[model samples]
Target: MNNEQRLLLLEKAKQFFRDEIVESHITRACAKAGKLSNYNVNPFLFKYLANFLKGNDDPRSIAEALVLPRVLGSSINTSFGMRIQKLISELFEGFGSTTPGIDIEFIDAIDGSKKYCQLKSGPNTINHDDVETIFGHFQGTINLGRTNNLNIGINDMIVGVIYGEEIELSSHYKRINERYPVIIGKSFWHRLTGKDDFYFELIDAVGDVALEVDGTKVLEETIDALSIEIEAKFS
Candidate 1:
């Protein structure tokens, strides 16, 4: 697609997230769980949410804030991580086919290689235990694929750390790294979009959409509405 078309699609995706995901899912879920109710409401939470909504220069923080509200309250206990995974998957689907699985499956357009992707938002998000567990599952999948004579294997898998610097890995992590290559930051985005600056372009596109949509106004209105509702419930 041309640059204009790509940007238009990105705008549509952001709007869909704001309307369908944030409004329909996150806001409603928070309301249902009484997140803004007097019993659960507090100045600190209010201030934090306000600050998050105000805006951040960091693209990752912007993306997270846009979706964080949806997973609050009862939704927090279920599907929180999955929700993020799905969002990332859908975002990449703009470039390639992102199929559902324990890890995301992306079919590279240039080489037709199917990459089974394990994504983490930050380096610290996955700890040593989490790495071991993920490696175990990934290894099992590779073995199962080999046993079934499938075309998938360790060569087709990648662990991507999205919004952080490269992590310091222990000996165990090093072994896992040897088996399944890990890519971080710019390399990860380059692999996904086959472009050197896809990450920056994406951030720019999202920022443009944010400005057009007046996200800060929407957030302020939302907070005000919720605060009034909570006050009414208490009064």
Candidate 2:
């Protein structure tokens, strides 16, 4: 696609993400947590939203770093990670399932086979123990499938880590690779979007959104609402 077309597409994607993914999920979480109706106006939310609305680079290492995971929790890392994971799944248009052992489960339209996906936010976010735990679940799925004479097996699983360097698995963990290999960084993005630069393009789109005049106004409004909510809730 041409530059203009790409930008337009990105804008649409941004809007979808903001409305369908981000806003919807945040609204539910805030309601459940009994926060302000517009609690999403906080700094962490604003930073990422403003960056996307204005198309600027995210100031924080992780976009949602400042948002709290729990009402009283200090960090929003987990929340941010979950959002990213959901965004990726949305980008791929995959079916999200809360299956016991997998984060997402979908049918490969080409092969007519089911695929289970496990997502991690960063490279080092997963360790030996994490792999083992997931593998145990995977094994359970396979065993159950076999006992029931189902078609599911090792070939149907994929593990993806979103950011950071590739994982260096030791010999013990390497066996896991035989059944379900972990994909990271470029490989992961390429597998999902068929474009190695998809990640960079997304970052650029976010920056571009942050640069828009209308985007700035939205940020200001969010901040105003947030400020009012904070005063009413805490004071």
Clashes of each: 1, 13
Residue-by-residue lDDT tens digits, candidate 2, 1-235:
3467556556765765566544543454433333345235465455565455546424331122222343224223455565765665555454676667777775543355677778777654556677688888888777877888987868787776665445553443355667786666666655555456766777666566445423333333334444455456544
Candidate 2 residue-wise lDDT at 215? 31
Estimate every model's Cα lDDT from 0 to 1: 0.56, 0.56
TM-score top scorer? 1
Q: Candidate 2: where are CA atoms >4 Å away?
A: 1-9, 16-76, 106-114, 167-179, 210-235
TM-score of 1: 0.57
* Stretches > 4 Å off in candidate 1: 1-5, 20-82, 92-101, 108-112, 167-179, 213-235
Task: Tell me the deviation in Å of residue 129 in model 2.
Answer: 4.0
Task: Evaluate model 2: give its TM-score.
Answer: 0.52
TM-score for each prediction? 0.57, 0.52
lDDT measured at residue 174 in model 1 versus the true structure, 0 to 100: 59
Model 1 per-residue lDDT tens digits across residues 1-235: 4577566556655765565455654455544533343234453554455466765323233323433554343354333334556656566564333333345666653466877777665444556677677776677767777887987867677776665445654444455578787766676776766666766766666556446543455444444555455455533
Q: In model 1, which residue pairs have backbone atoms overlapping below 3 Å?
A: 26-70
